[model samples]
Target: MELKKRIKLAYNVLANKSVITKDDQIRSMLDFLGIDQAETKGAVSEATYYACMKVLSESVGKLPLHLQQYTEKGGVRKAREHPLYNVCNSRPNKYMNATNLWGSCEYNRNHYGDGYILIDGAGINTKLWLLPSKNVEVWYDDRKILGDIPDIYYLYSYGGGILKLGSEEVIHVKGFDSLDGITGMSVKERLKNTVNSGIKSQNLINRMYDSGFTAKAVLQYTGDLSDENARKFTKGIEDYATGKLKNDGIKNIIPIPIGATLQPLNIKLTDNQFVELRQYSALQIASAFGIKPYQIGDYTKSSYSSAEAQQLSFYVETLLYIIKQYEEELTYKLLSEKEVAEGYHFKFNISVILRADFATQVKTLSTAVNSFLLTPNEARSKLDLGSVEGGDRLLGNGASIPVGLTGIQYMQNKNPKKGELHNAKK
Candidate 1:
């Protein structure tokens, strides 16, 4: 009830200018819609959802994904231009691109505690469509867990129906859910109070600037002609004070009658107070959504080094969780039975986030070449350059040679050394 009142307050404050009705009428309109005013106050009003969505969406969606197969030497290499890779890269479906799909998944997961992708085919599940958590209900009976494919999902939106997919269809991607429910726990559900508080603070700021600024004053009209005239005079005073009767400073001075007195009211809210309150509330919202303050372009509590570290921490701590969830789900459900047995699986280019500055890249690549971990051509490939002649040969001065006798070692092994000959002759 208290939250509903706060939502009503926020709604009234935002909608104050749209209608001339009293506050009760506005509350009735909101209530008639069966909408909990605070329901949208979480993501729609608070900065938490926007900041989290921007970071998670662009980072997860824009960065490339790869389809990789194990190589002869047992090292996994990306199968570039693979059909599945092209599908995920260029288009996930007819309606949305890869960025939009992944961003929607991450956003829905954050808001609803679960994200789902519906695959239409049986093997090599490539055909994908995203579903809203609220619309798709997970249908799992006792035996549904042991089956290869997930249980049939009942989709409620767009003229509802049950989706009877074949085996290994309808991929389920969920975040951390301690109760082991079908969907993971939603961030909004847990942080309702914290989020609402931030929103209420914002609404408070809006209220302060919006209709809340009306100053109440005392006026003494000693020689009023009639009750009707006094009411008219009071209305004029309100219109003038609130700037409703604007005359572009032409009527700056008003000559009062014989004994009329009006003095302005003393308001308590100051400019600095709102600034400080808004900043403090922002930090609270940022923390609730696992976003750093600076990520949302709030740098008041951040420095260069700390902000950089916070970015890395966000990738490792926050983004990694969601990425891994996708990777595992796709690998398990998307791959064919033979492909899985043959070691074909899924992996995201997580190291893409580790791209360094120019100087750092040069230093790192040089070190990798010197250590023989990357051949010169491999290093060139990283820099988007073509391979040069003789760049394929691994060059290093380390004693850990490849397991084969060189010409020098074989010749020395065939004949006695000169030093041994000299000792024998002596």
Candidate 2:
């Protein structure tokens, strides 16, 4: 295609309502012009990126998602009797379990900037289907063709055709970067330079190995040689250097032609600090994902205490955002207005992941039970222990007194007819 025509077509494509997105049109135009864009999915090949994805996906997927209801006392309990409980807590669909579904959703959210879940069916037969973010496009119904009110719609491009779903039919978990709040900006779009640099550094190391780790050098000779002789000499040097022409199990010791001296260029990898640059790039990528270096196995500066603290920091700084978005989307999309108004919502059992050491857990639970913050059975239930007799009631230390009785102890020995001095003596 001609440049002008391609540009016109790109503009038209961007202007079209049926197009995937404006970004998609721009990317397609660049692709047509032989310009390659670094893809977010391609970053998964990088070790740190893969580790970050795994850390987040597993951390969230392994935790139990509960359909909780608020009690009269303002405490929450699992609403196991609700029809959505099984869908949220255990089996989401016939093919995938809750762990796989939630993990895939989280993975897609981080990789593609938005994760989608199709809320299929209604009432007791409802099933959740995880949709690929690549095929799903967020579209606005400015004309209100789908409904009486202007709202957002999801256009899922599948092999058969495009499936238009309403906003209520899909649960969309958006990433950290979103300007319009409808579509999210991917990590690849935001950190393209960093990702490309990391990929280039990896490729450079790989090419060095492939080239037999040879340094750039110039061949010096006293006399000019024929083109044929020069070509033969160059091929010989390359074959020998790359071990393609090995003798006596020796390689990389290229034999110089007669009257020729090879002068190597002194550009050491150390001088460039290639390793340090790559390490820095890794840190930057990890930071972009809100991942700690220790989580990805770069524990150079980590200690026992700091590592434990990083676990909490990881939850607060990284997983907290992901979990909150998931909870909000799931609750809003999966529950009806009545259910939401009645305090029925979806929540992740974060305690499953934020659990402390056994000793710490025991002490913490004991403290909660003794302080009357948790009933004895509640503390036992957290530890997966069955309740004992009289465990349902809250336990507390005997030192606490009612607020109204605060000054009663001081007046215990007071007599209405006695003076202050007589009462003090008594």
Candidate 3:
């Protein structure tokens, strides 16, 4: 009942925002909701505070009826009879931790082993009912220790407990040291190795193309090429075929002779050969300038023989050289201008206000002051305050005043007429 009351109070406090104040109030509320005191309290070590928080957290969620049920059902014995009993009894192993025991058979069985049991006893008329399938059967000293008996006899007669069957229980026991020898390799490492090998093969093909091998050279290296590299090269060739190289000004290059020309050359350059020629030329130019080819426009063909087929190898190589030069020139320009510009600057002004009743009065006063200071020009103009200036003050009466002074000034014309004195005080 106390726990229920505390839970209700916590819910009410969370719903109604007006009752809470200070960090301690929040801590007390959390304590009443059964949150761990150590987790909520940080490093504060006052005995009374610790005791109060502990009692509150411990008492929270604990019902008298729950205790009575536990007592009537024999507490721990009833818990052992629960469906989760076999899962809890299984010892923790290297692959399976204590937390794994809490999950269903689907997740836990994958690593730990199949830990479920199914025993059918009910006939068709009664509908199927199952007793737990026993894995390991324990025999008493007096009973003949020969063959297996029904699990029911072990449960009812002998005090010896029976463990439900699992893969681990069925298989012969292997020690912890066995896992050490089973090399643990990751998917990422395998993928990386495959990619690196592809890159190397592509580099070799590029070298071959630069050495003046024709499109057929790519087919020769196709056996050595990885699936990933082949796919990439094929994609590059497709892009080349569709005139995408127009951006690099190689779309118009025609290597093959027209119909009028006699004995036209058959240039069957493969994807790898084209990549090789472009990369080789780019590298030569980049080497001359003491830079990496990727820093420039590295020519990438859509297909294996795209460079040779489209006759864009020379132009693409030249473009990469120009790109490298342009990048270097732009970088130099940026560095030269960096010293001329100034860094960022900012200004701040702080105002402090003090009041005895902080919660009720100070908050209101601070808000009003801030609102007045931040009011729009059109709104401030209605009060006849000409333009807002830093440190300028406005009196309750329609008067513009300077800051740091508290007085009203009046100017009088000095002249005595008839029976009136100009300097008379009201």
Most TM-score-accurate candidate: 2
lDDT of each: 0.68, 0.83, 0.33
TM-score of each: 0.74, 0.84, 0.13
Q: For residue 138, give model 2's deviation from the true position in Å.
A: 1.4
lDDT of 2: 0.83
Q: On residues 1-426, what C-alpha lDDT tens digit does candidate 1 reach at each position? A: 356776676676567533322334445556656566664534556765567667776788866777788876888877664557766666777899887888888778877777877775543346688876666555664466635654544443433334454335666777675476566777667766766766776676576566436657887878637988988888887666666545566234444556888876766656447567767766776676677777887877575474346668878767787788888788787776787777677777765676767677778888888888888998888877999999998877676544443334444455768885444445
Q: Model 3: per-residue lDDT, tens digit, 244-274?
A: 6768886644232232112323454463486
Residues 102-186 of candidate 2: C-alpha lDDT, one tens digit per residue: 9999899888999999999987999999998988888798998877889999988875678999999998999899998888877
Q: Lowest-scoring 10 consecutive residues by lDDT in candidate 1?
A: 17-26
RMSD to native, candidate 1: 8.2
Runs of candidate 1 with Cα error greater than 4 angstroms are: 1-42, 122-125, 143-154, 160-167, 211-235, 247-267, 270-277, 303-308, 398-426
Instruction: Using TM-score as the measure, name the better of candidate 1 and candidate 2.
Output: 2
The Cα error of candidate 3 at residue 324, in Å, is 70
